[model samples]
Target: MKPSKLLITLLALGVFASLAFGQRRNQIEFYGGAAFPLAPETFKDYTKVGLSGNAQYVLFPSPRLGITFNVGYEAFSTDDEKFTDALSTEFTGQTASYWVGQGFGLSPSATVKSNLLRIGAGVRPYLTDPEANTQFFLLGQVNFNLIKNDFSAKEIPYQYDAVNDQLFFLTFNDEEY
Candidate 1:
């Protein structure tokens, strides 16, 4: 099935379940999981991995389901820095090493947060705890992510002086990289 159709189906199911379940106050939850980039071919000279986690609160509109408010963190990483260094080092006798840190994302969605895994065509399943006051669960969420690329690490630069056949090395702060 297409992503758009699947998303719409999940939304409809969420609404139905929320209206059927009623409301509860002790509905807080926490979850952690990892994500991977889907379209690596779209980007050349880059490889990405995504990591994620969340804390949630469910507010039931009706017994079986509720609308979930989630605050989450996600990350994406690429090898662009290394690729760039490779291209530059060939022309000059200097070798440069660079490390690219991860990229991050945040997700918020309207979906059903429930304990029971409804069996059938359009139901979404949620992982839950029946025995804890402050519960922990895992729910798969489909969301469009917005990424902010900040944060970097230190870099090292080295040069081979071909004329004198001598080696030189320099260290730099995160800002220079």
Candidate 2:
């Protein structure tokens, strides 16, 4: 994300926080849970259901109205076999004549991650008296979601030999190209 966009987002959240919490009705909430994949069959096939966590602050200025601010993170790990197969299929279907590979044989040192950050704010309106110990509410929220993926497979270790009309790959000890 660009600095300017991030700045704007922070400013917006700050504005929401500045709204008052009155009558001594304020709470902090935290949650840790699993993230399920719901869309795009390919994504579900390649990535496992992963971890998610969140924290939020809620302030109630009046007995019936509450404002909330939240921050959250989510992560998903890919299944190497499925992910590599998908990539290879896509690459070969394209003009990847110079490329011939099924998988990278990525070592433990290789890193691959898909992560997300969420910042959001919302209003909660109490169905019952918030001043009472028991309360019910409806919430409506707007969120900004940012995703980052890090993929470092190290060297792919694939080289094509024109004379031999073949591809040599995953051979770390073979120095003579």
Candidate 3:
């Protein structure tokens, strides 16, 4: 099926389920948690940690069941200093030798950031009686995500010529998707 058609169908199903169940109570909840990347090995040189938050509105058709609509955002960032430290540790001797031979010094800086937005519909089933002050529930959701990534870096190399008594400077800037 086409993407647009599939979206419409899913929306219709959500509406049907809500109507069929009948609304008894309405609630809004806000929640947040730490996020961990699934593939840590893939990003071996970098530390990966993220934070996510969501707001959900639930319609309880019956005490035992509820239909939920949710929207959420998540952000992750990797520090360039940590990356530089890793590289320096791995190639310290080689880098020193190269710099001594070339009569120059090198400095590098970089940062990477990523973001995600999610929209979803789901069902929450209450395990305990709804009248209870505290309830345990299980949630099942289907979500659509919009994602973006950004990377930026700067490198500078400098050298001094004793005979010429002149200083040379070079700069590079890089930005990527």
Candidate 4:
């Protein structure tokens, strides 16, 4: 199944299970947010920020301790326009043996995307008294990710005409993360 659909199914199951627990202090939560690529210059050069959604089940076994299970999904597509411009710019004023003394121009289009499914467990320890209206806690988690990528394009191989100095579509390459 699609990752997003699986996430929704799991979330629905969690909601039903939460109701079955019958008045316990345990909780089921749904949350979502966005992330922006940063720090690594290469990552920022090719990715646009994407939003993510998650479902979490927190089990309060004691007044100060909670165990958590979570599942989430996020995806990002390649910055195609920016990447193509960069490629064209880089190839400009360049010649290759295959060019046969006439440099070929590049005009390519592509769709490169990546998706992630994260599943994990963690422990959260409440710092303040349980009776307090507000509390702080520390959490530690270990996660496993199921990742998928859609690297596809609709374009033919780069074709160049040496005699007439003409160039047609350029080939699309898979750029993996």
lDDT of 4 by residue, 1-177 (tens): 999999999999988776655334888999999856563576568778877889999998666888899999987656865555454445543223233334343335555576679999999999998788898999999999776655544332244556976665455445633
Query: Candidate 2, residues 1-177: lDDT per residue as tens digits?
Result: 999999999998877656544355588999989988675675566667889999999887766888899999999877754444444345343212224233323331223467789999999998987557887889999999886655543233345456966543331222222
TM-score of each: 0.39, 0.64, 0.62, 0.63
Model 2's C-alpha root-mean-square deviation from the true structure amounts to 11.3
CA lDDT of 63 in candidate 4? 68
Clashing pairs in 2: none
What lDDT is reached at residue 51 by model 2? 95
Best by TM-score: 2
What is the C-alpha local distance difference test score of each model?
0.44, 0.65, 0.67, 0.68
Off by over 4 Å in 2: 1-21, 39-45, 93-111, 131-133, 154-165, 168-177
Ordered by lDDT, highest first, the candidates read 4, 3, 2, 1
Number of the candidate with higher TM-score, 2 or 4: 2
For model 1, residues 1-177, the per-residue Cα lDDT tens digits are 999999999999998767556344436767766556555353323445556666766665433334565666765455645534543354343334321221112111111111111111111233454434654544444444454433232232234465975544333233346
**lDDT (Cα, tens digit) per residue for candidate 3, span 1-177:** 999999999999999878766545689999999766665453534536789999999988776888899999988666567654444334342332344345544455545566679999999999998778898999999999886655554442244456985434433333421
lDDT of 4: 0.68
The weakest ten consecutive residues by lDDT in model 4 span: 93-102
Which ranges in model 3 have alpha carbons more than 4 Å from their true place? Answer: 1-23, 40-47, 82-103, 156-177
